[model samples]
Target: WDEEPFELIVSNPPYSVKWVGDGDATLINDPRFAPAGVLAPKSKADMAFIMHSLSWLAANGTAAIVCFPGIMYRGGAEQKIRKYLVDNNYVDAVIQLSGGLFFGTSIATCIMVLKKGKSDNKVMFIDASKECIKVTNNNKLTPENIDRIVDVFAKREEVAHFSHLADYAEIAENDFNLSVSTYVEPEDTREKIDIKKLNAEIAEIVAREQVLRSEIDKIIAEIEG
Candidate 1:
């Protein structure tokens, strides 16, 4: 803000309905609003809230905004705004939380970290969806779980199917889809199977069938004779 000199800005913004979108013209012209375009369909007010946070961000300060996953990859106004920010390299990190984290809704959410005047030309993404365990019926991020995520982001490590550092060019190639899942895939839960075990079972069954056929052949021959 013009009156304050803050370093870091972080908050949990509202992600709800009745948000201004393509129906408004002022949003399309605002320079601080990133893409100079419109937001996607019925995403509630996620992008609008993000834009507000981005504008208040200091030259060297950082702001973390919580939003629904739609803003990352949706087309139209939302994509345009995101492209503008990413193209200029304002995005720092996008952390996706697991489903069931929020009650009354099963939708997974993501946190967008933005930094002004960043020297690094890369964006960090963390797939933290599986990091938290469920509490009662709602999933929550434990202190250690939060620490783990923060550590990963700070270290910028290349984790397998977890975190990734992507440049603006790569994001552009992906049409500005910043969905955490797009960059960091959730760990595949499909159980690893043993091919040898399957083959052995199949072979045993075939051998038993062969013995049964032999017995049937002998019985038919004896009866005919």
Candidate 2:
């Protein structure tokens, strides 16, 4: 408990595992949880790990933790902790990756980047949900995909439909929701159809069907006559 703080902290902790949370009354007073003004819920320990990482982080450290999607938008204690991080400029960036990237589950996960020393009040959000390719039965991030994500993270650029830099006011307006989708919009990949062209095609199909029906009627009349 008396070692030097970590300059970089990275972890993919057990997602949403149960923890003591506020059950251990003393945890509220812990330096890690105290600044957040509340403890993570006992049933969801995701934020607990975040707080611990933040505490152990050196003044210039950056912590990147893999998190479940729920932790990004869950209300109550988690929201309060998000507010604390955002207000204090500890949050650096949030990246959402495609589902099925991990084994045994197809649930999408997000990476939350936190820093003890930040140069700005804006938080960068990256929507890399479509950055992976389907490999066998699972999705995998190829070297190219990884490079794309890393490039955006490194430049902190605002790429349309890919990344966004949101200020504190924007986060506050959204009620402190840290979900990447809130900032970086997903690119609409659905095919664009011209309704007029589609309707014309349908009209042509119906006209051809009527002509065929008329021909059949004439053929039947000739046989009857």
lDDT of 2 by residue, 112-173 (tens): 99998898899999999999999999999999999999999989899999999999999999
Cα lDDT over the full model 2: 0.93
lDDT of each: 0.81, 0.93
Q: What local lDDT does model 1 show for residue 116?
A: 82
Query: How much is 138 displaced in model 2, in angstroms?
Result: 2.0
What number of backbone clashes does candidate 2 have, counting pairs of residues 3 or more apart or in separate chains? 0
RMSD (Å) of each candidate, 1 decimal:
2.5, 2.6
Model 1, 75-116: lDDT tens per residue? 776787788788778899999888888768888888899998
Report residue 116 deviation for candidate 2 (angstroms).
Answer: 1.6
What is candidate 1's CA lDDT for residue 148? 92
Lowest lDDT 10-residue stretch of candidate 2 = 1-10
* Model 2 stretches with alpha carbons more than 4 Å out: 1-3, 196-225
Model 1 stretches with alpha carbons more than 4 Å out = 1-5, 20-31, 34-44
